[model samples]
Target: MTVPRAWWARLPDPVIDAVVVAVAVVDVLLSLVDASPVEQAMAALACAALVVRRRFPLPVFLLTLPAIMQAIVVAPFAALYTLAARSRDRRLLVACVIMFALASEASWLLNDLTSDDRTWTLVNFFYALAAVAVPVLLGQLVQARRDLARRLVEIEEAREHERLLHSQAVLTRERAQLAREMHDVVSHQVSLIAIQAGALQVAATDPDFKEGACTIRSLSVDTLDELRHMVTLLRASGGRASELTPQPTLADLHRLVTTSGIDAELTGELPPGTSTTAQRAVYRTVQEALTNVRKHAPGATATVRLWHADDGAAFGVTVTNTPPTRPSLPLPGAQQGLIGLRERAELLGGTFESGATAEGGYEAILRIPAGTD
Candidate 1:
């Protein structure tokens, strides 16, 4: 069988009360040589109230203040202890002032009946003041410490909230960037697929129609593989802890132009890592330009020029296509392609401009800071 411990053993309230009562009994016994048993009994009651000082401070102060006037040895100190332990609210302060006034007056009155020396009365008055003020001062210090702790906790919580908001903003921007890349890669490939499929369908009665179909299937498989690789790279590198494979840089512009229907010309030194941003930007720019060409400039040849300067400090891309022989077809409304390219350029603190050239050709120029990569 398990035995339970006494509640007072854990709390120590009972032991504290016992000690206070013992001291009060001893003080009462010493005062008995001059005072009555009734006076001693009142002092004992006041000392006992000290045990519950923290719980019922005001009541203890009121009960003990009058008793200390008759038996000054034990009751006054116990009342001072209670006053010190209680909070410095209006009620507690008021009670302490009243008790101090009463105790001072009582000391003067008692000393008048005994030896009436001015110096001795002054000494007793100082002791009475010290007893009352010390406890209240200690309580104020404790309250100040608690207030400081609360402020520290609030500051920590505010910093945590700010960190969370910053992280969320970064994640939101990264996801938007990823969506734009995926759109550029997939849309450009799909446009080529549509063109090849159309060509195969038109030549269905021709002898080489089966070979064109086979080429379309092969291109489709290659497009899917590139899409999967890009997706894996984007997702893996998105996290801080994940290691990612090297991605295609500006060096891969030749492959990008060849894959798309545009003929590209490189003029200056292309910087490293600018390829990812440049590729996405140039790809989307050409993709949109080609789309406009097919819709508005059929049979027009598109020319692309990529240049890097400032020792790879900056890079620029230009894609131009002549106007079609036939009348212009009505184009679709503004969509993700142009908007995504503009966003990508803005992200790198770059500029994107698309308009009609003097010779009836549509042109797009993207100038980006290579150091941004």
Candidate 2:
């Protein structure tokens, strides 16, 4: 089955079929000595049938039975091989092989009468069966080889697709982290610079000093705007770069708690019309806290509370988890979620705090001014 390839493998289908038919004709001619007109016609039919054997293997093989009955083998052998190579039904192929062996001995079986002849016929039947089995086995081997080649190609394609998805996921994570750092650190610092420059410009007595401070404030404000756009683009990196998804807000908190994969309850609500940034900070704080509960405190129940503090100056979210009921795996992590959450809160003029509670539980809280954007 692993034999070196000959030049014939590269031949076109039409050319190969032409060659097969020509060879089958030559075989029929060589075996046609003293053959009757009916036998000659059947042999010619078998030779011609080889041209269409690839497309109609079973029928072509049946067409060669008459020639096989007249003791011609080459045409029948080719037809049986075609049948076995194309057919997927094992029972059908086995039946065809039996039919082929019977056809090869049909003339002798019809005329035999003597007991000695009967014994010889049985021996010839098995011999014919053995001979016909070679093509069937060879045809099956070729089928198996073709199937294996196709399977290997499919596996390689699947692996390539998986690699592409993995690389995309990595790129998305990196872009999101970059966006967070830019929004939380660079934007915050630039805003402060702009605010102080404006303050200095208003207070400066000299005309030159006032002009310089005003120029600095303008540039800082422009840079801060550009950074915001960049952060938006980076956060939306997984899809269209310019398109941004709706940022999460306090209204989404209930759904977040339900889907956080923890036994959690939500208890309080902030007044409506809070700034979008403050709402987002609250949402992220709860999301990160619930994630930690699932990861480090398996089987722990949690409570997420949203409340406006006394004096009505600020609102906040507090997420607390009970002690874990089951041990947790020591899963490796970058430990960036809490840090990111804290940075996000500071960006909104808020505070983030997390700690192990007195009862061996965990708590995370984010408080932001109600009026801040």
Candidate 3:
């Protein structure tokens, strides 16, 4: 079992009270030697009361008051000290003063029970009052110091939290700046490519070269459309994580197939009220798969299939394409499309599968949980 944490475990309160408990025990012993058995009993009771004085300060102090006639009293001082340090009301201070006088007089009377000296008793009485005052004064100082320490801790914590928030704000602004720079630079370059393609289409007389230029122009327009969408996201969110725009969903797969200029078929059905995230993931998967078909299989036909679990807990997309017609369009760089798609699926607690079929065709499959609202 875990131990309960004590507030005073790291504090002087425990150490100070430990020594005081020891002193009270010693006083119990001394009273047995110097005074009557009745006095010794009272002293022992006072010593025992000291054990809980810290736990039950005011009550223990008040209980110790009647026993003060024989009180060698260590408990009362400890109790008064606790009260002084913890209590805020002025009424308790007045009570402490009155109780302190009573305790002091008791201590003095008990100290010289057999003495016949009146003037000396008064002097001893004053001495006892001074002794009681010491802990009260010390307790007040300790309380003030503790309050100051607590305030310092709160201030430091607030400052640390503020610093972290400021650092995050700076990082967000930097990311948005990087996105803006990329939008400006890449958009300019793509626009130039589109212009050159348009010029080539106009200047060229051969049908073959003109067809190539038109394809180039089409691809350029599509790229610019995707780029503008991204740039608008960066501007809107101003953060690393982009807020979703109107991403193409399963419903838009027909448009995607037409744009790919491929012989294609789509089948199966999307569940009613499918989630936005699942819809986006399905669209991207199909889009990327169709792009792959265009690049690697050129004139070959592709089929896209989408389905939902009977219980409406999961939705899926599968894109498969026939083998290449011949040597096709060259694709550069590492192909991160399917890898990125797999990550997106897994992040949503879903799955992705892709491989070449026995028929010499390639198939890419993605499944994502259609979580309820």
Clashes in each model (backbone N, CA, C under 3 Å)? 2, 0, 0
Best-matching candidate per TM-score: 2
Which tens-of-lDDT digit does each residue in 112-156 have in candidate 3?
Answer: 454566567777667767777787888888778666565455446
Candidate 2 lDDT by residue in tens digits, 1-373: 2345569876888998888888888888888888999989899989988989999999999999989887788889999998888777899999999999888878888894699988888899999999999999999888877665644554465468669989998888888888889999999999999999999999999999999999999999999999999988787765533338777877788999999888999999886788877887788888889977876786799999989977888989899999986544455678799999989988888888899999999999888886887
lDDT per residue, candidate 1, 310-356, as tens digits? 57677877888876543333444665666777887898799888888
> lDDT per model, in order?
0.65, 0.86, 0.75
Best by lDDT: 2
Q: Residue 169 in model 2: shift from native, Å?
A: 0.7
Runs of candidate 3 exceeding 4 Å displacement: 1-19, 66-73, 106-127, 183-185, 206-219, 236-373
Error of 1 at 244 (Å): 29
Minimum summed lDDT over a 10-residue window in model 3 is located at 324-333
Best-to-worst ranking by TM-score: 2, 3, 1
